[model samples]
Target: MTSQNKSVPAFGYEIIRDYALSTILGKHADDVLYWVGKDIARKFPCSDIQLIISFFEDAGWGTLSIEKEMKDGYIFQLTSDPDLLNIKNRKFRMEAGFIAEQIQCFKGCLTECYDEKKEKQSVVQFTVKWDTKEKIG
Candidate 1:
């Protein structure tokens, strides 16, 4: 398929995301998408948190904002534009997994990510944590 404009509309992309991906992946959508995100992070490694935040925006994932940074981990929140938020048709596990892998690779330790979706508030929060004592070699 070729487009004269060379840019697909956001609605078109969402259609593929909502229908194509779900249809293809079916029951394993969540798990597979998460792995795919991790794979993407591996291929395009981010050198710093700034790059990670930019990656999210550039990829049309959403706006990533750091809420807090703690000794062992960090908390981030993702929010879409008001229009997109009203649509309520997003799958963010992919983002969470991507972040988990990135943090794990960067810190050289075992890492985990937890996502909380606040539909009412139109926000998705991701908590990424790594054990400093546990290193990955």
Candidate 2:
């Protein structure tokens, strides 16, 4: 069998990983060489980058990529439907932010919540920062 059939196609951990990483790269659509903390994050009890991407893809998060750097961490990006920005429950944001803070240099996540009026769909975002080493990493 080919490598494609050698493993499970999806897992929850991957979903979490993809979500966190993607949130980082989502900071700037034009930013390059995006890097994020993987080592410490790897132990978070869920999926890794690729699997996470798959999970998000299943949930309709669109395509994703992980740009890497050995010492600086990794960069995870996701391109998805603009209208589906759901942080409907503020609790989710709190939980995600808390998770990010626990990682190594948790660079925080940027969420583009669309503002309803203005003739165009404009998104407003927030960044929450922390150091994983200083917390649970």
Question: How well is each residue in 9-98 modelled by candidate 1, as lDDT tens digits?
Answer: 777887888779989999999898889888999998987788899999878778998999999999999898856543366677788889
TM-score of 2: 0.32
lDDT of candidate 2 over 7-113, digit per residue (tens): 54334434544464456646542222121223223344233445545644554434444534334244343444443433231112322332232332333333211
lDDT of each: 0.84, 0.35
Which candidate has the highest lDDT of all? Answer: 1
Off by over 4 Å in 1: 1-6, 85-87
What lDDT score is found at residue 59 in candidate 2? 40
lDDT score, residue 47, model 1?
Answer: 78
Clashes of each: 0, 14
